[model samples]
Target chain A: MANMYNDKVMDHFMNPHNVGELEHADGIGTYGSPVCGDMMQISIQVKDDKITDAKFKTFGCGSAIASSSIATDMIIGMTIDEALELTNKQIIDELGGLPAVKVHCSVLADHAIKSAIYDYAQKTGKHYKGLEGFDPNAEEEDHHDIPEEEE
Target chain B: MRQVYLDYSATTPVKKEVLDAMLPYFSELYGNPSSLYSIAAESKDAIAAARKQVADLIGAGEKEITFTSCGTEADNWAVMGAADALKNKGNHIITTKIEHHALLHTCEFLEKHGYDVTYLDVDKEGRVAPAALEAAITDKTILISIMFINNEVGTIEPVKELAQIAKKHNILFHTDAVQALGNIAIDVKELGIDMMSMSAHKIYGPKGIGALYIRKGVRISNYLHGGAQENKKRAGTENLAGIVGFGKAAELAGNNLQAHIKHTSALRDRLIEKVQAEIDHVYINGSMKHRHPGNANLTFEFIEGEAMLLYLDMNGIAVSTGSACSSASLTPSHVLSAMDIPVERIHGTLRFTVGDMTTEEDIDYVVSTLKNVVNKLREISSVSSKKGW
Candidate 1:
């Protein structure tokens, strides 16, 4: 079976479209593992609850690299609330459906967004309402973006 | 693009002649080897002939060979059965930390059952010294199981020296020769091996069939209990077609042994030379002097192994970070860890194994692809570190 991730993902991974960290960023989130062969470090610049700028560096499978790339593209123009609502399923759908085993790559992308938001909340002393007891293994549709009864 | 397969240590494609010999058994002459009819009698003869072929490969009597479902099962039977039988003799097992999971996990299982296991450490070259084996042995040491050659780093262990030591102490020694079977020369008598495991898939026979070599007059208990097959050592109906294929493959391997070794060793050396010439901050994993002829494990610093694998796959060049069995495991290799490789480089390790079919062109292609991939990953890592998010 030919592995699915094509040149777009390979191009980004080989010469990552936005390779490097953000200086004086609003938030930064890194996920995956060097041991497991997939890692993503994402930085976000948020203004007025909307993502003004986003960039990423991922070390992983082609689909993982592409998923992170496509994810940053999807979230850059959206509100923090919109990006928080992004699902791994949606990412797979967007990329023409990843192989069943490679579905974890999509999940890594979803977690990167949440991680960045959590970082933002940590830096600014605002509650990360999007990450209230987030269970990474839970089905995408079951988890809430923000808990209904936040203090 | 011409692709290369450098994972022969994982498994090999069935040889053409082995396949040809096996085709008729699966169809026209399909009959139970145990049945007492004309067709069944012919099946019995084929099974007997296969037994002789496999025995000849390792220089054992046909009665001493017990076929199993796979190498893992053979290993389990050797460890578990022997431990159970010799409970009164000793409760201690000695093995190296670099053993494949087949022996490692079984030793762990035995440990849980109150058996004392001393996991001997290896030097940076992935070789467990014979002196370590000599020191580890005690009156309570019932068995000592080490691999003939590592499936990961491909370093040939000091099995002969260890076997001689085991003999002096009268300890039953077993070697997992699954990866070493056809690629290298092996004679049970020559090495004084008491019990050894062999897998057919690794020798270009067929999958789902392997043999365990038990030296004559060595009494070990049975793992599977059923029909009086395999001299009542192992049970279940014989996989006749697989067994026959294994025999033919073994015969072919014996005939082409020297040529295959010379070709694979040269191709592997070419790959190593190319990598060393083109790359920097890389180190070979196992001992250069005592390694397998076909195995080359190199660790490229900075980049992760999985990312490198993805990049290589993109270019249609296949290799591995470790053995095929443990490829998905998130932990840095236990084998590499035992060798005390640093965490940074462990993530970057890649195993490139040559096979009978591998050529100089295949090695060059892999070298070029690897050079390109490493440079790219390193470039990204450097830029990302500087920005400091």
Candidate 2:
């Protein structure tokens, strides 16, 4: 069962690059729920339209925690538009790959990124193309969009 | 890295004595028990001795035991066979909500086949009330099946009282005693249990071997059909080596029952006491007084179970969890849920079962490792911070 996740996922889980909260951050986004067994909170510090720092605290399994860890590491130096374009697929690819049931963990990471950007947009009265049709409130349903396949 | 095995309820390592007893059957004594030859007679005699050994452990007659593939098969045979045999008399079956999936799924299958099943609820400690079993019974109720000891939480049900209620109603009573076989003393006659399911592996015997005990005069349909094995009820070639191993294991267990229980219970108590003393917001899941000696189910307040299990695994310690993330179905344990544990708490539950292999040093290592793991997990857990723990 340890082989369910690749070395990268285990590495990220064991030694997460960015963890804890970014105090007085520009934006904060929390995705997933306790009821569903995976919850993540991603905080970002944005400066001049680029993310200066990003950190996360996750309440989830290995994959979810690894996804959040890697997602934070990926979006730290990117501009808001570049961060918005960061997909769950990129996170999965970066982490080698997750089990099919755990693909939703990457999806949660993607949503957490966008939701944080949305919160930043709302705070700064700024809007971007990626923000179109993005509803942070729909996170509960969005994480469930990935069909949970039995392993 | 230190390796400590504390998941004995999941399965135990086969004892050296059992393995030595089984070695000959795989080579020299390998013969079809049904064949009318000297070699076959040896095989047949070994099976008979094994049957008696198993029966002796349970205070049952040799004729009452029927070997099956595993405990699941024994449970399947008991519930499905009885439902089919008693269908003419009734279609209703009574069972507890905390049964192992072998019995619960069998009851579900029976439900699909036009049987009405009443899933009696368990108390917060995972105990099924005899009154609830009595209330669920109807004129059409033909059978009542309950687990002797719950697999997840280690709660031992009031089987004797529940069986008495079934006997009063003239309904057949069955108990899945897979976890109870070597851990506790059992007398089918004393308990009024008409049928009981058992597995070998849980008692330090080989896997892939199980048995069902049918009290005399209780008629049930056959589960398998082929050769005339197992008194023509379960049909299949015998697992000779496995049966021999089971016989040896049962004999050893019977001889050392008190010592095994004392050793395992001491280790379990030490582990629990240390964890409770060192950890905060940890709750034991089942009744302390009425549980299997080796079993301890603990719920860590703010962290999920799989994460802790993985950490423990990395430390070379083995354990089990009732968390949804660890389960194939992506749902928390039904047994914990049925016991009225909060859904979030169910995700945090872990089961540690000690056995003959466990030691005081192993228990200390587990407690220390668990403290570090729980503290580390809680450090990053949002739930823990939210609860301000």
Candidate 3:
């Protein structure tokens, strides 16, 4: 009740764009886990060093789904380097803003794009400046697994 | 959009009668109950009458009830009070893992103070086994606190049988009956329960008011001390309006207990049946035979609970979820977790509780909306296809 989503977040959640797996995807990246209660997968189709299409599949809350939806939409038609440059803050800004607690969803989106780019780089044996020292399996910052106080 | 409320276990709307009974207390009858005057006498009489009304609902004596800020406070008083009073005798308390945080946290607090606490595991249906309880009892066990009904899964525990065990051991028994007060018929004497905690908001009464039933001769230490209020045990100026509303609600609940149960159960069963018929891979949580009449907790496989809840909210249907994403703590419901439900399934669980105001049409709308929500979420879910759901 404390974190009512803005209309933009709700819009993407209610009618998310680019939802589902992309056929012949050049790169697919999955982030988070079901155990953490939020998991997302982003599939990208690249052509001539540019992202032609982007899609997502998510098992998570409204904010996570919304973040994935907006992030996918934002990455389309951008060069691989531009797509990799997408940040969680930009995703939050694109969706107007998300709840403070749900900011991790956007962070997951950021890692998801970078992870897909990392996969793409690995597949083509191409090195990109943005891929420097990016660890896909790195733990998220302050993942809120805090248990609620008993009533 | 049609707004429908199906979260009665969380709280109920105050009834008109209860509201009407409380209105005068906020203005004309605002005198302190402790004041020595005619106006104070009116307040005193009102509180006394309310105490009797609440007492009658649970078949307890008027003198046994003490008003508190809320059910959480009552639960705190019961466990903490009993612990302090019996600390010299014993330092051990036994409670189920499925208890609401109020009791669980109180026990935890006692543990921090060097008391040895045993958190008894509940069965798959969220029912505490009497044998496990008996086995856990030790020479230092002074109190046994268990919930009468689980708030999330709606499983009703065997309070009578468990209380008998505690009585046999000569140990005090307290029940967090907040969810059971109006939903079930409770006779403290018949159940041999030494203490019970109840909330007004859960029973179609005003909030910020609850009562702890302490049976005669139960020597629990005072929860609060400042003045002679609450029979010199709890010392606070009474919540005059809230007490009146609770009393009226209790009286009405007692009078309509049978009809309320029949109506809410009918709605709950219809919702569950309809959803199961329309949706695939949906399973009810907890025991249907031994559950709160209005509660229907179901796990929708391969889909998360918060997504379904938000989708339903878009259609003007309000419900609750046990999923970690929806909770402030980011941890799934402790009640469901204690029942050994799989972590994934726990994230997929939704709790729908019908009440006096819920109607057949509302249930139908929920079922139809839920079907779409579940199907939509599953469509975008990565896990659903893997499970062939």
Candidate 4:
């Protein structure tokens, strides 16, 4: 098959940005697993309703790791509200384009950022109306050995 | 830099001798083995010799070995043929959960046909206990199919003991020894197995050809219809060139079994020791002693297998992983899951199988490359955050 990823995905995957943790983080969102197809942990440094810094650690396929890395760069320096508005499609689009199967990984990245923002809100006793329905503990149901591509 | 291949269990390059043996059957000596001519006689005789070569590797009678398209075909015939032939006797079949997809999918196929199949679980080491098999057997049990060597984990099953259990209970036994051929020794006669499947590609032979050893007097209905080829049991014209390659490869395997084992296992052992010493949170998978000497299956904690695979590939090192991200399924390996390994750990599973051509330099290079790759992935995986390292 053709190389599923474009040049931009390869670049981010080969040299991911913001790869470490903050000594003191405003919020944390972890998703996926080494066992699961994609496990990503996103840490954000929030300052006065703005995401001053963003970093991620990912355990997944090339596409997944690239998604997490690119997602972190996309959210950095953006306000918390702006980060919340970032969609998975936008994250994928920014990274050129991810394979159709790997679009879920980008979604994981977007969800992780939102989930982190939610963590910050819950801790600081602030409410974001958009995240009212969001459960920080809830995740997209574990696939449990099911294939995305059914024969 | 020369690439180092450590995925021999996946497949091997055809040996020069084997390829040379096959060339004649393809271009020059090519003839219909069944035709009534001297040229045809040569093809028929070569095929007969090939059968014996294959049979000799496993210590079976020449007639017991029936050539097939490939290992999957052999396995399919074994499971489907036994299940169909014994339907009148019983509908229940017993097999381990760690079998290749060939057997697992075939059993699932049988389930749809009103056949009952018991998918037995494996231990943490990925071995199916004979006691487990004995207990699962009942009046409805007609056949027991288990893999001699697991393709992913490299765990060697108790095929002999399991076959004996089947015999005492008057049931036929089948084993997919595709991964076992050439790498491990087998004596089907001594093991008392009713049937066993093998493939050539894994043994430095050509692909598209393999063999199934069916014990004399065992009743199995023909799998393919039409042609009178293969004793009218398996249809279609023979794959002469491929079969010829398989025979020559089998002969080499028989002659070099001990040396091959010692050489591969030494490199495998050293690689495992170095990797464990150099890396942390990495545990070797499968039986360290009972497993194939060439296989080193390991899982690096908190790093995805596919990511590690990509990095190794960049370094010109070939390896395999059980992670679903590397396959179309996008699911973890059924074999690892069947071993009851936590799903999280299963994502990092990797298999590095050495072969005859592997060298100390190659092993060292792979060790260094693996250390570099796994460390990079784990560094990115945030193992420090997970463990407060």
lDDT (10s digit) by residue, model 4, range B250-339:
999999999999999899999999998898888888887679879999988887787788778777889999887777767678888888
Give me the runs in candidate 1 sitting further than 4 Å from their true place. A1-16, A20-39, A43-52, A61-64, A79-151, B323-329, B382-389
Pairwise lDDT winner, candidates 2 and 3? 3
State which candidate, 2 or 3, has the greater TM-score.
2
Model 3's number of clashes is 0
True contacts kept of each: 0.21, 0.50, 0.65, 0.62
Stretches > 4 Å off in candidate 3: A134-142, A145-151, B387-389
Tens-digit lDDT string for candidate 2 (A34-134)? 77777788999999999999988877787887888889999989999999999889989998888887675334788888889899999999989998999
Ranking by DockQ: 3, 2, 4, 1
lDDT by residue for model 1 (B342-361), tens = 75567678998899999888
Ranking by TM-score: 2, 3, 4, 1
Question: lDDT tens digits, residues A1-151, model 3?
Answer: 4238998888899999999998999998988777677788899999999999999988888888898999999999999999888888999999998877677533478888888888888999989899899988888655764444432
Q: Write the per-residue lDDT of candidate 2 for residues B197-302, one digit (tens) a residue.
A: 9999999999999999999999999989999998898899999999988988999999999999899888899989999999998999999989999999999988
TM-score of chain B of each: 0.96, 0.99, 0.99, 0.98
Error of 4 at B27 (Å): 1.9
Instruction: List runs of model 2 lying over 4 Å from the truth.
Output: A105-107, A142-151, B385-389
**Residue B192 deviation, candidate 2, in Å?**
0.6
Chain A (alone) TM-scores for all candidate structures: 0.77, 0.91, 0.90, 0.88
Per-residue lDDT of candidate 3, residues B92-112 (tens digit) = 999988888888888888889
Which docking category, incorrect, acceptable, medium or high, applies to candidate 3?
A: medium
TM-score of each: 0.84, 0.97, 0.96, 0.95
- After superposing all C-alphas onto the true structure, candidate 3 shows an RMSD in angstroms of 1.8
Question: A16-66 in candidate 4: lDDT tens per residue?
Answer: 888977778999988755445576789999998888898888778788888
